[model samples]
Target: MSIKNKVISTLALSGAVLAFSAAVSAQDATPSTMEKTEKVPKRGGHGDKHKMGGRRGMMHGIELSEAQKTQLKAIHEANKPSESAMSEMRELRMAKRAGTLTADQQTRFAAIKAERKSKHAAVKAQIDSILTADQKQQIETRKVEMKQKMQERRELRKQRKANQTETAKPVAG
Candidate 1:
């Protein structure tokens, strides 16, 4: 094969590897989930300092008093998964990635997910109680704005895909 062909093959393989890793890690980095079930980057590592899980993300753009901040921090700390649980979750994620998760491990993973869901809900309630009515309204408005932005992005992606499909068509000479 020519050198050009070999370089193309290498680039293709690298793209595939990156795509696969991103797909596998997507769930581990769910923006909506409070508990980090897997060992991923910190919540604000991507320049989204406020777009964290739990109440922090939901309360984005809403001002909080010093007391409220302290309370929410305490709630977060109190509800964090134990170190053992985090370790088990990391192991399970690895097994899942390797396609070696057994039926028992699947069951365990499901239980852990459920526990995290409940804990997230409980923490959200506590945070809600701390917020004033006006702050809640601000949060709701932000949510609506974000939803609109997401919808626009989806439409844009669809249009881009359509254009690509059109451009890829073969023209008769």
Candidate 2:
């Protein structure tokens, strides 16, 4: 081929290769939106049920007695907030997220969150009181595993963001 024709052909081939590689790399580099959506548990779904089951449920999975189940369920029920307070907290969170909350409202929201967290900790302590040393150890192990998994997830998200930012920059000649 003539020199000019050879250069043109080479450029065309390079462009085609870049496009093909981008298409393939895109598929491998990013997770599908559906996959991301599936990773999030549905509200009031199995996740909620598991959380509601609390330490008792976790122990049950490891084979706690019927009496233990009854005790655990009682603990969970007793610790559950009154419906009105739960509703108010939900409303407050929604309002805050919507950017409709004022400074005073934010203060109240912080107080509510603190109160809920304290109550949750108290309930957890009560549940722990019922657990044997082995069961408590098991729960602690599970908590550590969960923390590790969460850390891994955060790192993955950070890496993904960095990759996205790098890819978005314009390539220089």
Candidate 3:
């Protein structure tokens, strides 16, 4: 997991998914509050994808050449699914969390994931075509660095969660 991957995963979990569910659950509340809570933030665009070669926050101090930046932008655009597919994915994710999915829904969701995975693989191939041999090797090294960072974050989160539970408990003495 690169830093970009980590950020995307975190945002999907804490931002988009949570916001939608929160809005839906609060539907019966006051109209003004509901309206404010229901607005879903727009997804990232050219700025997010092309800015710093999609590793804006992740790869500190490393900069891509003009050619590399252009190729990365093209690769990102090519890999992005259609708007309809993204909407369907969002709906399926919300439904999965809201309740048990029927057999058909489960099958459809699985197919969508497969399609997205295929697109990702194609994009990766395109990116590799643009990179120099040394850059490709550097990416592999970065993957290892990212994996270690991810594990450390997970452990830290677990410890924080445990401490919260302990503090919340009342002493029996």
Q: Relative to the true structure, how large is the alpha-carbon lDDT of every model?
A: 0.85, 0.81, 0.79
> What TM value does model 3 have?
0.61
Q: Is candidate 2 or candidate 3 better by lDDT?
A: 2
Tens-digit lDDT track of model 2 for 1-173: 89999999999999999999999987867778898778675576654446655544445355567776688889988887898988888988899889999888899889988998999899889878877888888877777877898899999999999999999999999
Model 3 segments more than 4 A misplaced = 1-53, 57-62
- Write the number of the candidate with greater TM-score, choosing between 2 and 3: 2
lDDT of 3 by residue, 59-86 (tens): 3344568888787777776666789988
lDDT, ranked from best to worst: 1, 2, 3
Model 1 Cα lDDT, one tens digit per residue, 70-163: 8888887888789999999999999999999999999999999999999989988998898899988888888898899999999999999999
Query: Of 1 and 3, which scores higher on TM-score?
Result: 1
Candidate 1 residue pairs in clash (backbone atoms < 3 Å)? none
TM-score for each of the candidates: 0.64, 0.63, 0.61
Specify the highest-lDDT model's number.
1
